[model samples]
Target: MIIPEKFNAFRIHQLEDKQIHSGFEQITLDDLTDGEVVIKVAYSDINYKDALAATGKGRILRTFPLVGGIDLSGIVVSSIDGRFKTGDKVLVCGAQLSELYDGGYTEYARVKADSVVPLPKGLSLRDAMALGTAGYTAALAIQRMEDNGQIPERGPILVTGATGGVGSFAINMLSNIGYEVVAFTGKTEQADYLTSLGASKLINRHNIEMGSKPLESMQWGGAIDNLGGETLAWLIRTTSIWGNIASIGLAGGIKFDSTVMPFILRGVSLLGINSVEMPLSVRQQAWKRLATDLKPTKLHFIAPTTITFSELPSAFDAYIDGNVTGRTVVEINENL
Candidate 1:
């Protein structure tokens, strides 16, 4: 493929032993990695990982002078694969797009043909970006729980980190599907917002005590936990017998000091969820669910405050400070 002469990209360039990413001067398609399809990106969204890349806080960029968004939705401007053609609408997420490859923080992106998913019939490109990686992860978690035999009639389920992107979507999707949802959040101020998202009860994050007890009173029938630390361990110990707990993010920390008594004695299960390496089939199913059963009635309420190309940098900072709520999508290409 002939690389275009000019394109726009948000790039992280090395400067004085540091990396900085923001709106910069025009970049060429020549700067992108080789792929079978070239997309004119319509929308992209900020994730926790995107925040790290924009701020250079983590080693999210495997290479420098890279575009930083991990997810995007767009129209294929050109394609080498017969399965896709020029002008095809599609979306992409969780395929090392930002970390190991040139990504969607640009006006155009060249992506491997197999890594893309066709936009679902009922979903618009803008709505796909609004759901983004967070909503997809939440849907995957819910699917896993159901596949593992979890049912709403068993008991009330718990959602930790309830105000963030994944958590907000999980709460609404679960509750909308007839499950009783108890939401936990550090932000007491967001109680009304969580309630509006269909959370049945709000549990104070501080009140979710993590003590030395190896086990505690049985509580949740199932759980979708985003923060994975002592809180996760506590959730493991307290989940009802034969319940499923899907462990997603690690904003709290990674280490889990847990006991096997919950597994052996209570038959509880801890399912680790990695949205990044999800197989293509599972990814397709998850997004289909997002457009159907797991779709949240109040999805717009969980959007990352929409921003333009120029406002992305500050939005990234707000995400890092934990000040942002739900999903934050960047509108590009005339909001198509």
Candidate 2:
């Protein structure tokens, strides 16, 4: 495993007019921000947030000319972090990569020692990237739900955005752990794919009418909602007594208009999952669970589609339009 002295990274530069232009650019090892370890990055994956950052649609980067990827997996070639050594395998997710810091879109990534996690034994590099932030969020959602008393024997668990990475993995993992999962998706065409991932039933996104009513009939025992706003509000209303709902993203919107009826009457718990600033112990625990108990048997069900660094600009458009499905991996450095 040879680490590149000079590497390629997808760099986003903001021009004077405040427009962002992103492309593949040559970068040197010395150009990366200082960190305790440098990884010979093998694979990186795109997330909805990554798409936003690349296009400058969101204020994803706190700085200019930043690398634009949120997740990475590979082997360590150098380490000042005593926990890691040369040739040791590892993967990093969250810990503000690509947000407040330079990140994984490059052939090499130098990250703070505290943010790195050793790759779990059973997972390959590809597997770790496949899980990436999406699967980690899914696990966090489920873990929160369980911590709040959700159980397989408690009727059905609903996973919104079912065709997307987080929802897809949530459905598969929840079902594999013995809970019946009902998936919600706008892509009706992906019905078979969702079912294959263990969704016991599918709800058309359009059919779940967003009413302003304070409460609705309790329909589900628990929910893992990636789309926030009205969908989350709706889920809260219809959740059974003592049910838990994990809110992970705002793909739908940021605001939620709901009343306290669900909480005060039904005792519904709305757990907010912040994958970015998770404690190191919890991060390690989640990855270990991803390698074991909460691991999805149909992990390849969310198989990644590879794209070169050069193709990112065009691929990003597709991502924002909700036209891309499953995970998309970028081949950063060569492996032989």
Candidate 3:
């Protein structure tokens, strides 16, 4: 692969007045953050965090300017690292791209060798981006929960924010592994959609009355919580004895009032799932599972949208406005 002197990159910059301005610009290899591997980026995907960073909606970027996209899949253009070389297929997710480093929204991406995973068998570059961070996060959550002794025999798993990408993947992956999966979402109109993803039941979040008690009647055996305010507190109080609750998002709110009663009285475990900054081995293993048992049976259903790189700027608003579901992939170099 020939490295171009200048290539197109969607760069994010903060003006002196503190507003974010992002658009395509021709940049050189030296313009990107330092990394050992240079990739010919094939596909990138949109996440809520990407939307926030690009639009300055939520202050996701630590630096003034960077390329925006948390996940990517591509072929290596070059690597100083011994483990990777030119023409190697690889993917990167949750490695702080667009947060602390220039990310995947470009024709070329320079990334840390430790953050890259060789494209697993059975997943093409586009398929890898389709799964991206959302799928990886869901797999990490389930893996952690199961590590903490979660089992289908314990009881059905309740997935909160079930219509979102991570929640949707969690519901499907759990069901495919023999666990009874229940989806908790405010969008009851999408009942059929949730059910098709293997949700055995739907709990309308808007209709349910969460009691204001430290410990409510035990309902779920375990849960994967994407909302972190009142819903998390309720899940903590109502989870069955010895159940695990994997906390992944804070869309509801950052703070949640809760007591240690669930932990002490019921022996419940609250596991926090942080996909970023994981050990290289752990990150690789997650993608390995995503290629096999945890591979979503309804992958296309979960991430049905594919947009050209030119269409990337206009796409972030839907995610910011919360009008989008599943996932969307951005094709940067389709022929790669």
Tell me the TM-score of each prediction against the true structure.
0.96, 0.96, 0.99
Of the candidates shown, which would achieve the greatest lDDT relative to the real structure?
3
User: What's the true lDDT of residue 138 in model 3?
Assistant: 97
Q: What would the per-residue lDDT of candidate 3 be over residues 247-313, giving only the tens digit for each residue?
A: 9999899999899999999999999999996998989999999999999999999999999999999
Worst window of 10 by summed lDDT in candidate 2: 327-336
Candidate 3 Cα deviation (angstroms), residue 222: 0.6
| Candidate rank order under TM-score | 3, 2, 1
Say which candidate scores most in TM-score: 3
1-336: candidate 1 lDDT, tens digit per residue: 234689678877656757564455588877888889899999999998998887877778877777879999999989989989887899999888888888888888999888899999888888898899889989999999999999987789999989888899999999999999999888889988999999889899887566667778888999999989888998988899899999998878999898889999999999989888888999999999888888788877788367887777777777778777778889767756
Off by over 4 Å in 1: 1-4, 16-22
Model 1's alpha-carbon lDDT is 0.86
The clash tally of candidate 2 reads 0
Candidate 3 regions exceeding 4 Å error are none
Instruction: Report every candidate's CA lDDT.
Output: 0.86, 0.88, 0.94
Model 1 residue 237 distance off true place after TM-score fit, in angstroms = 0.5
lDDT of 2 by residue, 155-257 (tens): 7999998988999899889988999999998899999999999999999989777667798988999999988988998999899999999998888899988
lDDT of 3: 0.94
State the TM-score for model 2.
Answer: 0.96
